[model samples]
Target: MGEISIKTEIPGPIARALLERKEKNVPAGPFNTVKTFAAKGEGALLTDVDGNTFIDFAGAIGTLNAGHCPPNVVKALQAQIHAYLHPCFHVMMYEPYIELAETLNRLVPGSHAKKTFFLSSGAEAVENAVKIARKFTGRKGIISFERGFHGRTYMAMSLTSKVRPYKYGFGPFAPETYKWPYPDYYRSGGLDPAELDEALLSSFETFFLNEVSPDDVAAVIMEPVQGEGGFIIPSKGFVQGVKKLCEQHGILFIADEIQTGFGRTGKMFAVEHFEVVPDIMTMSKSIAAGLPLSAVTGRAEIMDSAGIGEIGGTYGGSPLGCVAAIEVIQMIQNDGLLEQALKIGEAFQACFDVLSSRFGQIGQIRSLGAMCAIEFVQDKTGKRPNQPIVQEILRNAHQRGLVIMSAGLYGNVVRLLVPLVISDSQLDEGLGVLEDVIIQCCQNQQ
Candidate 1:
């Protein structure tokens, strides 16, 4: 794993064949097809059909927290598969489904009376959260932050801020949903570079009052670290400021921790890094160790407002997923993986910091544990995305037998989400390869 191994030219022959076949049939805009082949993953690395092994950084979009095909998760699925496949929790009320709910209620950030229910994806959880908020608050307007990415489903996409790809051409979205400036220092006007903390929070408070009449809003949704917009971090007073605003308005505060949960940000949840707690939280991605599962955990009174049979689905809390989650949470607790994520995050920072310092193209290097990203720019002053350079690096990285992902609204940020199960040696090897590609790409930049 130390040295770069390029046995075949990137996609190789087998991968190319698969992609050519897929391109004729699959929807092109759904996802950017990179390798022309699917992954056969084990731990931190993925082997393509070409037999080229890549130090994977995708982590299956953060769903493989326990690593691809962890022995325990596999065992749990095997155990559950024989027990029963579907009893439909809404009707039969199985043990693992209810047990997983209890686990989520206990684990998610918030000391209030908690209740949990399963959903199919982050979107369903988000939509249900809004439904619960409206039912509880008896209000119409829902407030979300700019540059926030909730999900891709119809309702979730409407709540999401980016209009170009997510909302464009998909007209007539959900109504009464409002957006305010998130504490994005790079873009939003609220943050004053010259001013101190007290003054900055006041500026944001002023914007909230002027923009959205607080009473009209039912819930205020926020991502602790703005994920897709840009890896934007709040200036210390920001999230707390928003929390106070929500309290004043009697609006429920919902944290979309789908991306930030399960030790991605080096904590159980990113909200754990902040002092204030959210009224409701939605989670997916890594909760059940690669199974299709999502949950909305919130205060008992709020979630209970929805009548029975109002919030459920056919495959929301699959027995297999529940079993996987039970084991995954145990692994997190027993193996001390939360602390390990912090350690790994430090390693990520060590490498990302070096790359950012060495290259002028690296505009900003932001990381909170393993959820790390580096934004690329053509010039320091403009801070505009250098898309060509980003694409080249991704292309070459694959060629060099390393796999990484490019994200952000502008598609100029390189996020490194290597699975937490990656061994120290494998992590080191991946980092070394990334450093070389970044350094080489920057050196050749015109």
Candidate 2:
């Protein structure tokens, strides 16, 4: 009766055949949330090969803010394919690339003279942003926060904070990258938010003395809302404080809005929430409505620091990606997705708040607009991460036709990256499935 329709087991006959084929052909390195291939997707609904319909709450790991295969995006891609797929921007130089650059320059915060360049993925953007920062500032060191998830390239990996899955066995990372403490207020061991902010901000001076000098630091790359770090939202003061430190020390503040940009956080970009403009911003996940496009937008002077042919790839800013991104920007602006994001966040918070009251294991419910997450703990007092419970909940939700994913270092946080365009009924139905699963799982645990 609801949006979910489970006609067969999760990995049905067709899916099982494909999975066996996938195992033979594909490497095991790539991770998958649900063990099924998608046949079709629209808005917030995805149907697998098994004929099971799921309410998509993961949104392709937050890449489908405009929802899967948006008609406008598909139409744009179709037209672009007929005209030309990739003229190779370096060789021919396309109009779509220039147009997308102009649009991002106008939209991505700050009224200053700005420029934008595109890449194929968020990691590529991060690598280039670091290169630009180093070139512009004439510095070698970069500082990233604890539990941050930058891309997996050598330079981006060095800047990333996670070790087990992202960094382990792939060491000999790029040098001069350092990690700083990012505030996790929920797990702050009774420290006041203001006190924690002040401590971390002040510790920068000590860090400069102890580890690396501030003058040698090229930039401090940060996620406006730490995506892989459990959707951790830093206080406005904390963000401003870091920016102030960057300005004082002549270090660029690079905002990694890859997961928080394009109406995901109710704002055009998550940096807008803090009212602090970043020197450079890396955006990707939801930027192109699922096209493999990422962008680095910043002040013209800083962006121009890289010499001709210094920072670019063969497929960087492909014509298809450029056109898709252009349409995506238009959709975000004109389709009421921004307002819809706020509504989704409100709905998620209301649902989670009720569940939290009933379940003490719900440690923290946090969001910046639709970028919402519910952290599960062992108990109310101890606040130990409950990874087992999260795993059970996700498994149960999947069986019942809700697609969700777990985040956080301990994998105890259930993150909701539901599409902004999801209908009210679909949203409720998805939440209902999640709620029922959580109740059942918790009761069983007890």
Candidate 3:
């Protein structure tokens, strides 16, 4: 990951003294608890605003799959910056934008002819995809899963499942958006795959029959590997079953790979791990390293249905962003990061296995390649979320110079996205830190 350097307390005197200045300048509500001001990041290490170095595990909220400022991305960004700043593809054609689209259209799963459109953010990409689905299908209802996170915009928030921070008091949200249950079999109330099979399929049956009848449904969107939904990998049959149902109902299946794409999971796309192929897919986050870019790639007919000028943004396909994406794809291909992710996955799982043995508090530790998560439970029997304990561990880890993040509908899952560029020594060091905190803080509280 990075060379260890501890010169001061994290958020030390420098950052602590300046945090007040920052809070006053920016709204306090925008920041999360346990905030640490960052000065700069290279690879997997972040030099904090206080001049303290931390082994970064957040990976810029899954937008740094290629690590911070990867040389390839940097070179491409620099080269693009010299050519043209902004002619706006709609105004004037640009080669990079079209090239990136062609690459994505070809790279994504699905044997059908696919097209791609660039956007500035995942939320925008999602919104645009929904617009296209509705425009093409003439359907008003959309189906998502509980605990799913789409985005923060109006439509995005409405599609998202959380309420406390994302949707509370933000409603009434967009109408015609419906939510179904995800087959989170781990916490499925003893509902085995067979039972989940009956439950989920029945839920869909009920929805199509009554609530927002199937005919009115435009799309059924999901994260093949639920990102914010606790890194929950659906049971083997769940995704396939769901996709079959969507096909049965003539619904457009959309996979939201915003957090799972760009090789965050073992494969280039999480959907590749599953057999079901989504008709449309939304990608962002790691696709262009840290750049603000997102894409909607789908079957030619569905995507092209929304006529020209029907959907587009000023910075939809910025040449600079496209340049970065092209290089990222190339690096992933040349460097074989996919194989590296497998090694990282094995190491990470080994770390969790040790933790699981030491403490029953670790109710679940599931991962897909590099995207790993550990669910903290109060008791082995109940599998109840122990958020308070998890928070304590996180705080302790931060004090010890490890930056991490949380996930799950219950917010009790400590998820890790150690940049694929992280070194073996760095991974061991970070794992050691987490192990120490997990034992000293999380288990002790129990």
Candidate 4:
């Protein structure tokens, strides 16, 4: 526990002062996992204003896969800053922007001739991808999966799945956006995984007949591994089946890789795990290592459907974000973070396998590479979501100096988005803290 030093309580003297100022100034709409303020960060560790150090498992909500302030990214950002900052891609184009675009074009799944453009956020990328899809296909409808999260922007929110926090009281959302069911095999109540996949895939044709026609749909947007939807992993057959349906219907398949991209899932992109290639992809979160950069990459012909000057922003492709992203990609490729992701997943699974056997509250522990989650239930037989226990575990874990957060539509899942670069010892320590906390919390419920 050397890396985790809880010298003072979570919101110790200094943090309490900061929190007072924050409560007075900042809006409650913006949520925070850790109640304290960050003083500094390195790799997978974050130091708070009260002099407490924590093993960060949230990874800034999947935005710091390269870890906080990676040396190469920081060095590159410093050099770019010394030279110049944003000249605004809309007015004066820069070379780093083109360079990063080329890198994504080659790296982001699909060997076909592709084109890439920049945006300031994941929502912007989704918005532009939707625009490109509509312009290319000249259709009006879009389809997203149940329990999946896109973003907070109007169109992205329309595609998102969760309510209460994300979508409650926010309507009326954009029109023509539809929801499709993504598979959750653990909760399928004894249904065979293959059967579930087949049923969901075959139901698409019936859906078209009952709802919107296939020809009227412009695109189907899906998260390769539903991140905000409780880290739900669908069968490869299901994903490929969706792609096949799109191919047959002349609708574009848009993979939203915002939280699952950049080595979060063993591979550079999660779509590779399913062996399905998307026509268009929206990427962000770890793209620039939290520099607020996103990309929309697609088939050259389709991306070009939007005439020049139709898609762009004032700070779309800032030089700093581009340089940081370039270094981030190179860092992932050269530094062996992909393999690290697999190792983290293995460690988490191994640790939780025993815990799940002992604790009936643990409904499931699942992972695809480093994107891992533990679903809490009332009991083994019922499998009713135990959201209260999840809340207790989160609070205890935070007090114990392990920074983590909860997810799932019902808010009963504890998701781990640990930075891929975390050392084995740090990972073990963090998991140990989480394990002890879960045991105590579950026992209390009993």
RMSD of each: 2.1, 0.8, 1.5, 0.7
Position 279, candidate 1: lDDT = 94
Candidate number achieving the greatest lDDT relative to the actual structure: 4
**Candidate 3 — worst ten consecutive residues by lDDT sum?**
28-37
Rank candidates, lDDT, best first.
Answer: 4, 2, 3, 1
Candidate 3 per-residue C-alpha lDDT over 292-319 given as tens digits, one digit per residue, 9 for 90 to 100: 8899999999998998799999998788
Candidate 1 per-residue lDDT, tens place, 1-446, comes to 26445678867898788888888998878776257465577788787787777777778777777788889989889988888898888778899988999888888877778999998788888999998999998888887877899988877887899887889998898888777766545543444733544565576567557766667788988888877776677754678877887898798999998888888877888888977788999898889888888999999998899997888899999898889988888888888778778877798788778777767798888777788788899977677788889899898887877878887888888877778888888888888888888899999995
Candidate 1: segments with Cα more than 4 A from true spot: 1-5, 186-211
271-296 in candidate 4: lDDT tens per residue?
99999999999999999988989999
- Pick by lDDT: 3 or 4, better one: 4
What is residue 178's positional error in candidate 2, in angstroms? Answer: 0.3
Candidate with more favorable, higher TM-score: 1 or 2: 2
**Candidate 4, 307: how far from true, in Å?**
0.6
Candidate 4 off by > 4 Å: none
- lDDT per prediction? 0.81, 0.93, 0.87, 0.94
Q: TM-score of each candidate?
A: 0.95, 0.99, 0.97, 0.99
List of clashing residue pairs for candidate 3:
1-423
